[model samples]
Target: MSWFKQGLCFLPVFLVIWSSSTFIVTYLIALFRHDVDIIFPYISDTGANPPESCIFGLMTFISACAGTATIYARYKYVEKLSEDPKVVNPRLNKTAFLFGMLSCLGMCIVATFQETTVTVIHDIGALLFFVTGVLYIILQSVLSHRAYPFGSSMFVCRVRSGVAILAFLAFFPTVICAFFVTQTTLHRDKGDTDYPYHIASAVCEWIVAFSFICFFLTYIDDFKIFTLRVRVECKE
Candidate 1:
């Protein structure tokens, strides 16, 4: 099949796997909260629950699948270009492959290390993974422009760049909130300062929510560009 057709086939499959894995992990988190209520009646009153293990498991699985897809897509694109010799730039293809591989490895490490037992290590790992993942996506966006400047350039590029900047801006507040929350949790042996911790935690929550929204918007833009290419090709 043509490059356009191959892209079309991969696009929906990637979205389905990506979206479903995220949804399942989120769903499991909610389920875990309900289960916590049964274990300790006072826990609901305190409104404190441990992070769900299921989310981490789901994240690992999703990252693996995504990593495989990234490697495969890069290889396939390179192979296609090699066959035709005039189809696409080999250097751009190699860049995509390299970044994709890095993203996969980063996610795997982040997911493996994100545990409540090692809160500091987990947070640091998460921060590293988050930065790397964002960078990888940004690199892909840049490379897409290099490959097909006019055809790939779309509104999504602006949206993603803006969102990524916003995420960076919010990072400080999130880190500060995390610090206060950690301190409060550590003082648990002394007394309960849940209220202050709750406020700080809420801020962190908002930052995370914003980050996810930004990521989704970026992916949506990617899908739009992929679809446009397929449609344009079909018309010709």
Candidate 2:
């Protein structure tokens, strides 16, 4: 592959790793803060916190770039795999990739509208990120059943796909339960947060984030055959 193609191939990969890492790091730092309760506060709350907010918001923007790159890579990878035309649907891959892009866009929006600063936009972004992202997961799960032009491990694909599907399937009920329970606490008690509901939502959000990361990790195996390497000799 040319240098440009090589860059394209790895852009999403690197961005994903960085974004995921930054998210974890920011959360860890925010967890120690006295104002926020690690167990119940949403991930977005971390982004709302003063100092850590910068890091979380930056990571979210990076995630959007990663998503754009992923969309490009997905199209190219699927196109390459579909050259034979006899097996596989390029269209399906394209659709999944589009969904992934929208998911990323949602993250960007959430970052732009931090929870404390603007709850409505942030909530909209959260819903968009989760719902469309899960749809992408489901589409990719279906695609895994088909054969790739380049070699693919059915076992790995199946397992990853299954996990994505199951986690996504669980996200809905988990969020709904959390919402109702949390709302009751907010309205009935007025001051006390429903720890159970808050904790549940936070957990579900983490699971969904994990699933998103895992789906992208599968790309590492797929990109294994494609490499960008440079050799340098010192003084010899």
Candidate 3:
């Protein structure tokens, strides 16, 4: 394989690094500015202010674009892998692609609208991202398992399954804890009875976010074997 073909693997690697960096940089900036408590802060809280918010918006937008590219590539990869074509249903892949893009749209919304400033829109965006993102992965995991010993390995299927399972498990706590806590508990009084829920929500949110990241990391190896190209044809 050419070096160009080899470089394809970097796409997923970039997504992982860039996404994690966005969270870390925003978290550090929030910490330095004392925008949030030193203990586990909501990922949005880190980027709810001026400087970090700016970086957060830009970085996450790029992350969404990268995520879109990753899903499309995987969609094509599976399409090519199908021997009977029915062995892997095109509808399933298309559905996964749709959900994946919707998740990216959610991420874009989350990026463009600041949580503190536009709570409702931001929360809606977040809902789109998390719910659809998990659905996307779960669908992809099923596809991977179905493709096993052909387009994918048993190991890859297992890993994707594990990550999808973790994300699914963590998602409920993240949402449930957030549901129980009020703004007063999250931002104002740590002494409130709901404070523990606030912390648990933040912790679970981080796990879900990183689980999403880890899920994509599995793609790096698979992406290594193929090169993506665009073809244009004319009928004369």
Candidate 4:
């Protein structure tokens, strides 16, 4: 029982829950501190706020750690399940796992440098994080489709694939638009924060975020099997 409990702490689910909770709390605090417009401001703005900077800084570090653990756990979990008879035909792609790990590293880089303090470094991190992140999602979606071809999970895998593509579609174009809009605004008036296109970009970014998050839900079905293994081992 103790071993089961201990092992549960290392699951991807645990890490994701921890990271998500930290982010939610940090965001709420930042929202309260700057209660102007929550939906329109980019996610980075919450972390960049003066009052919540320190807390969100720590939150990013925690997220980096959790991201690392989550990717590793997810790889191991899926790899193991691929060998099961229930799987249609398993193909374990180490390349996908490697790319996923790189995404986590990108996340760490983003967390280490604040956007407000170091714009260039932060932009690079964000670039790596999102580009590689969406790549990982697409690759994993392919891997999942291969892993779960005809089971109940197969449908979820397809859904994940769709969501991943949606995230990519929503992210890249909006990113270009946002960059162009911000640049145009800066050139026009340094003091103006009234760029309507910026808010549009923020909204699209949130859409991308939601889609990416849903893409990860494909693994939720595996949690039961993993947790069951823990309980059985503990029982034995």
Best by TM-score: 3
Q: Which pairs clash in model 3? A: none
Write candidate 2's Cα lDDT for 1-236 as tens digits.
45335434466467668878866777777777653555545677666777888888887888788777765666566667777666668788788888888888898998788787887898899888888889987877777667543545887678768778767776886578566553521112325556566666667877777777777767655654554345898995
Give the clash total for candidate 2: 0
Candidate 2 global CA lDDT score: 0.71
After TM-score superposition, what is the CA distance of residue 31 in candidate 3 from its true location, in Å? Answer: 0.4
**Candidates ranked by TM-score:** 3, 2, 4, 1
lDDT tens digits, residues 1-236, model 4? 44424443445555556556655666787778763246556666667756666776776677667666666666666666666646623434466677777776766766677667887887787777777778878877777776654333767877887888898888876677677565421122324564666766767776775565565555555544453232434554
lDDT of 1 by residue, 25-104 (tens): 44455455653222112111122223545465455557556655645554464345345445456666666566556555
Off by over 4 Å in 2: 1-9, 148-151, 181-193, 226-236
- Per-prediction CA RMSD (Å): 9.0, 7.1, 2.0, 5.8
Runs of candidate 1 with Cα error greater than 4 angstroms are: 1-51, 71-100, 144-151, 183-236
Tell me how many residue pairs clash in candidate 3.
0
Candidate 3 lDDT (Cα, 0 to 1) = 0.89
The C-alpha TM-scores of every prediction are 0.55, 0.81, 0.94, 0.76
